[model samples]
Target chain A: EPEVTQTPSHQVTQMGQEVILRCVPISNHLYFYWYRQILGQKVEFLVSFYNNEISEKSEIFDDQFSVERPDGSNFTLKIRSTKLEDSAMYFCASNQGHFGEAFFGQGTRLTVV
Target chain B: AQSVTQPDIHITVSEGASLELRCNYSYGATPYLFWYVQSPGQGLQLLLKYFSGDTLVQGIKGFEAEFKRSQSSFNLRKPSVHWSDAAEYFCAVGDGGGGADGLTFGKGTHLIIQP
Candidate 1:
C-alpha cells in the first residue's frame, strides 16, 4: 500500500534557528496535514492543507510556523525560529478526499537545543 | 468543539488474552470516530473508523470497534492479542457532517502484551 513519506527522520537544530520539515504525501491524496507529538504527550494537530492552501490550523501553529506546497508532491513546514518546546515527532498525513481515512508517514523527530 | 477521551493510561495483558480499549467522545453532532496505533518511534497507523451504517466496524490486523451513539463512545476490541500488539493506541473524533478540520484526539492508551 502506498504511504506518506517524510524526510530527515531525525534532526537536531539550535534554538532560534530555522527548520524545515518535508513530506511527500501519497500521489493521489488531496488533503494533507501536519501533527506533532511531544514526548509522552498526545499527538496534536498543527495544520491542514488542501487545494494549495491552508484549510485550518491549531493555536500551536502560530506566526513562527508556515506550510508550503512548493511543488505538486512536496509539503513543507518551516519554523522561523526553533524553540526547545518545538522539539517533537512531526507526522505528515494525507487523505483521498474530505473526511476520508488518512494515512500517515513514519515521522520526523525534531530536537532543539 | 470535538474531543476524545481514553480512560486507561496503560494496560497489560498476557499473549492470547482478549483486549479492549475504551474511548469516549464529546461532540454536539454525529461524530466520525477512529482508532490508531503507534509503535515506538513510528507514525500513527489507522486501525479502524466508524462513520455511518452498522454500529460495529471491523478493521485491519484483527481489530474491531463498536460505535455507541447513546454513550458517545467507540471502543476497540480484539478477541486475541499477540506479543506484537504492544503499542500506544489513540482515539480521535471528527465532525461527521462537516469538513475534515474538526478532529480532536485523546492522549492514548499503551498496551503491553505480556508473554
Candidate 2:
C-alpha cells in the first residue's frame, strides 16, 4: 500500500535555528496536513495544505511555521526559529480528498535544544 | 468548535477478553468519527470510521465501533483481544463538511494486555 513518507526519522536542532521537515505524500492525494504530538500529549493539528496553499491552520501554527509544496511530490514544513517546546513528533498525512481517511507517515522526531 | 473526549486514560484486559474504549464528542452537526491505533514509536493507523449509514461499523483487526447520536459517542469494541492488540487507541472527530480542517483527536487510551 502507498503511504506518506517523511525524511529524517530524528532531528536535533539548536534553539533559534531553522529546521525543515520533509514529506512526500501519496502521489494521488489531494489534501495534506501537518500535526504534532508533544510528549504525553494529544496529537494537535498544525496546518493543512491543498492546491499548493494553506487551507486552514490552528492557533499553534503561528508565523514561525510555514508549509510549502515545492514540487508535485514534496511537501515541506519549515520552522524559522526553533524553541525548546518545539520538541515533539511531527506527523505528515494525506488523503485522496478532504474529510476522508488520512494515511500518516511514520513521523519525524524534532528535538530542539 | 468540535472536540473529542476519551474518558479512560488506561485500560488493562486479559488476553481473550472483550474490550471497549469509550469516546464522546461535542459537535454541532453530524460528526465524522474515527478510531486509530498507534504502537509505540510508530505512526497512527486507521482502525475504523463512521460517516453515515449503519450505526455499527466494522473495521480492520477485528475492531468495531457504534455511533450513538443520542449519546454523542462512538465507542470502539473488540470481541476477544490478543496480546498484539495492546497499544494506544485514539478517538477523533472531523468536520463533515469537505474542508481542509483536520481532525480533533482525544487524549488517547493506553491498552495493556495481561497474559
Candidate 3:
C-alpha cells in the first residue's frame, strides 16, 4: 500500500512569485506525472517524467513550468512566474511503468494571489 | 488523441440506494480505462481499472465497472451506497496507442448521498 507523498499540503503565493512543489513517488515507480485541477474543472495533465527527462507534456505545460528530479527521492515542479490563474490543486502521480497502476498523492493546493 | 466524458456533472441518491455513474471514452485501439474517487480536499484514489479480459471489473468499496467495447463506455456502479460514498468520481483513459504517458480525465461527477 505504498503511496505518493507531496509536501506543503497548501501553498499561498503572490502573482509573479516563484513556487516549487515537491513529490516523492513510490520507490519502485519509473514514471512520474503532474496534473492540475482548477476548481470545478477536469483534471489536466501537465507533464510526465521518465528516465530523468520529460517524456510527454501537454500544451498547458509551457515555458513557465519545469519539472526536475532534484535528487533520488524528490520530484519537484517549479513555476518560474506564477499567475493568478495558476491557483489550483496540483496532484503528483507515479507508476511503475507502462500499463502499471498509477497512485496519486493527496495533492498540494497552490493558491496564487 | 484521447479523452473521457462523464455525462452527469452531479447526482444525488438516497442512502442504501443503488448508484451508477456513466463514462464514455474516445480512443483508438483497446484503451485502458480507470475510475477514481476523490474526497473533498483530497487526492484521487484508484477505484478500479480495465486493461483487458473480462468486461466487468470489480474494485474496492463495493464498486464495479463494465467495459462495453461497442459503445466505448465504462460505467461504474454500486449496489448500495452510503453517506461515505459522497465524493467526486472521475473517469480516465490511458493511451493504449503505445506510450507511457499520463491519463486523460473527465470533468468528474459529484455524488451526493442523502441521509
Q: Second chain TM-score per prediction?
A: 0.95, 0.97, 0.96
Alpha-carbon lDDT of model 3? 0.93
Q: After superposition, how far is residue B79 of candidate 3 from its true place, in Å?
A: 0.7
| Distance from true location, Cα of B16 in model 1, Å | 0.7
Pairs that clash in candidate 3? none
Q: Candidate 1 at A79: error in angstroms?
A: 0.4
Question: How well is each residue in B1-115 modelled by candidate 1, as lDDT tens digits?
Answer: 7788899999999999999999999998878889999998788899998889999999999999999988988999999999999999999987642244746789999999999
Best by DockQ: 2
Clashes of 2: 0
Give the distance in Å from residue A54's predicted Cα in candidate 1 to where it truly belongs: 0.4
lDDT of 3 at B3: 87
lDDT of 1 by residue, A1-113 (tens): 78899999999999999999999999998888999989888889899888999998999999999999998999999999999999999998888886678888999999999
Query: Which clashing pairs does model 1 show?
Result: none
Better of 1 and 3 by lDDT: 3
- Per-residue CA lDDT of model 2 for A49-85, tens digit only, reads 9998999899999999999999789999999999999
**Runs of candidate 2 exceeding 4 Å displacement:** B97-99
User: What digit string (tens of lDDT, one per residue) describes model 3 on residues A1-113?
Assistant: 78999999999999999999999999998899999999889999999998999999999999999999988899999999999999999999988887678899999999999
